[model samples]
Target: MKKVIIAGGTGFIGTYFEKRFNDIGYDVKIISRHPHNIQWDDKKAIVEALEGSELLINLAGKSVNCRYNEKNMKEIMSSRIKTTNILGKCILDCNNPPKVWMNSSTATIYRHAEDRPMTEENGEIGTGFSVDVATNWEKEFFSFNLPKTRKLALRTAIVLGKNGGVIIPYRNLTRFGLGGIQGNGKQKFSWIHIEDLFQIVLFLNNRNDLEGVFNCSSPNPVSNAELMKLLREEMNVKIGLPAPKWMLEIGAAVIRTETELVLKSRWVLPEKLEKEGFIFTYNTLDKTLRNIL
Candidate 1:
């Protein structure tokens, strides 16, 4: 059986990957802060896990769902960089390192663009704390010199799935009639179904020719209004209360998350994936929502 080692494999995405890999007959080893298979601090254990593993995916990062205060911001940046740096070192030390290493990156690295979509080949990188975090994370990931291993930075957008993830909370908001167009509702919301995300990972792993940054988002990015409208329809809600910018700021403060999450216009396009002939299972927002719901 092919062995796969995942850092920070206890989160929603990691857990989903674990199940999928197991179903496909791969041995999944998780390296997390808390011991599931191996602890993050255990250098020997991590090295041992990475040795001879077919694939190594690092999804270990502090969740960006909190207020981007001074402390949280530092942690968010450090967590991603530190984990990725450590994993790179472990892979370097390994006698038989994984052939492919998929590191987590965010589509938020791109600037807020009301016109045109950002792609891997021509995307404009943004500024501010979020962008810095993503930029620094990728810098750390690509800094390693591994001629034998193919490294892929998954510049993922918001991933929607069942039970958990960005979906359930938004679904609940829709159910509660709080799901409304955020801010001016013109921001481009880029997202992908969890299934498609898994497929993309598998696709990258299978194809050795593919490398570097790949935008892991649905090609069909919808406006905020369109996204909320679809969610309202899918949830069978007749009315949704709209939230203005000021209200969003207050709500974000109360919830301990950043309003930039909803307000940013992340119009990302998967040109590389499409050009590579990767077909998404759920391309449209309606279909994706239906599958998740």
Candidate 2:
């Protein structure tokens, strides 16, 4: 049977990938801290998992949905760097390494561009804590010398899916009449449906010629104001109370997450993926919101 290994396979994205792969007849192995999964400390098991596998996906990192305090900052950086380094080492130990390795990277690596969209070929790298983390994470991932394996970094945007990801929070906001435009509502909301994201994974696995960084987002990026209006329309909510920047700051403090998650203008485009003929099922915000809602 075909084999695929997913590191940090307990999270929302990983879980979905596992199911999709399994349903399609791939033998999926998970490396996670959770019981019944291969533990991170077990290098032998990791090496075993990578050997002769068709593909390896590394999503092992701390969630960035928290206040960037001293401890969380250190953890967020270390978690990604350490796991990536370990995987690199294990791949080196493999006699027959996986054909392709897809590492998770964030679209937040690019600057908050409101004027134009950022692509893999022309995107300007941003500075700051989150940007630093993303830069270093990709740096670590590509540092490996796997001559047999193709390496690709998935710079995924906010994923919209049923019962998980940012969709749940957005759905709650719209339901409670708080789905108004966040901040000035000018921030570009770059997003992808979960199904399209999954299909991209399959597409990349087959396209052995493709490597390096690829932005995973819808081509039809919308403004924050437009996003809220569409969400209300789809969800049948008439009155959405817009949260100003000041109110968002307070709410973010109360929620223990950063405002950058919503306020930043992530205008990213999947130029490489589209140029290679990858089609997104949910290309527009309305189509995505309708499916998820």
Candidate 3:
């Protein structure tokens, strides 16, 4: 069986990718600070896990749900950049490095937009704390010394699945009949189903031609209002509170993440993936919602 090493394979998306690759007959090797039961030093872990593997997928990161204070921000950046740097070093040291490296990236790197969709090559660079986070993350990811390993930086959108992410809260709110729009509900939110995300990662892992930044999001992104409407309608929720701007600001302060990020208008689109002829099984909001709900 073909082998692949997955850093941060114990988390939500990583777990899904692990299962998908395993189901397809790939010998999946997982690596992390403490991955399930397996243990290895950073340098040794990466090289050993990737010894005969075809690819290395990096998904290590601190969760962004909490406050992004000075210390937490430092931890977030270091967790991703330092781990990536160490992994890159391992690859550079190895005589036979993995053929492909799909480093995790975020779609929030692009400037928020209310109207136009963001293509990989055409989107505006973001500003503020989140942008700084993405910049450092990318800087470290591209600093590896290896030349044999083909790489792709995936600027991914929020993954919506029954098991995780922004949708879970929405699901709870809808179930309790407390669902409503937040902060005017006009900001655009880009999303991809968890299955589609895993499939794209696997596709990129096997496809030698796919490289550089690929915006991994659905072509049809909906505004926050539309997303709320769909969720409430599907969950049979009626009569909910509309969260005002001040509440979201207070939430931002309380949660430690940037208020602007939560309210950022990002109309992201996956131009490169479509151009490269990658098919997304869950593209439409209706289809995706039905599958999960």
Candidate 4:
């Protein structure tokens, strides 16, 4: 069986990948802070895990669902950079390193643009703490010299799934009748079904010619109003209370998550994936929502 090492494999995406790979006959090994398979601090264990592995995927990072205060901001950046740096070092030292390394990156690195979609080739990187974190994370990921390894930074958008992910909160809001248009409702919400995300990974793994950054999102992005309308319809809800920017800010503070998560316009496009002829199972908003709901 092919060996696969997934760093920080305890989270939602990691767990999903673990099962998917396992189902396909890959021996999936998870490395985390806790000792599920191997602890993060165990250098010898991590090195042993990576030895002769076919793929190395690092999804290790602090959750950005909290208030971006001084301490949380520092931690968020440190967690991602530190884990990636460690993995690069290990891969370099390995006698037989993994052929492919897929690191986690966010589409939030693009500026809040309602005008155009951000693609791998011609996307404009944004400023501020979120973008800075993403920039540095990718920098560290590609900084290492691994001639044998094909590296890819997954610039992922909001991933929707039935089990656990951003979908849970959205579903909860819809059930409570608060799943309405946020702000002026013009913000673009670029997302992908969880299955499509896994497929993209598989697609890239199969195509050795593809490398570097690939935006992992649905091509058909919808505005905030349209997204909420679809969510309401999916949940069979008649009414949903709209939230102004001011109200969103207050709610974000109460929930301890950043308002930018919902307010920012993330119009990311999977140009590279599409150009390579990767077909998404749930391409449209309505179809994706129906599958998830």
The candidate that wins on lDDT is 2
Screening candidate 1 with a backbone cut-off below 3 angstroms (N, C-alpha, C), the clashing residue pairs are none
| Candidate 4 total steric clashes | 0
RMSD of every candidate to native, in Å, equals 0.8, 0.7, 1.7, 0.8
Model 4 worst lDDT window (10 residues):
33-42
What is model 1's C-alpha RMSD? Answer: 0.8
Give one digit per residue, the lDDT tens place, for model 1 in 64-95.
99998899999999999999999999988999
The superposed Cα distance between candidate 1 and the true structure at residue 74, in angstroms, equals 0.7
Candidate 3 global TM-score: 0.95
lDDT of 4 by residue, 1-293 (tens): 89999999999999999999999999999999875579878888888989999899999999999999999999999999999999998888889889999999999999999999899889999989999999999999999989989999999999998898889998889899998889999999999998999999889988999899999999999999999999999899999999999999998999999999999999999999999999999999999999888
Per-model C-alpha lDDT, please?
0.93, 0.94, 0.82, 0.93
Off by over 4 Å in 1: none
TM-score of 2: 0.99
lDDT of 1 at 113: 88
lDDT of 2: 0.94
lDDT (C-alpha) at residue 140 in model 3: 88
lDDT of 3 by residue, 1-293 (tens): 78888888788888888888889899998876674634536566667777667988989888777777788888888888877887888888787888998898899898878868889778888787777888788888888757799988889998888776777777886777657888889999889999999888877876887778889898889887888888877877776677778988886786565566548887899998898888999998988998899
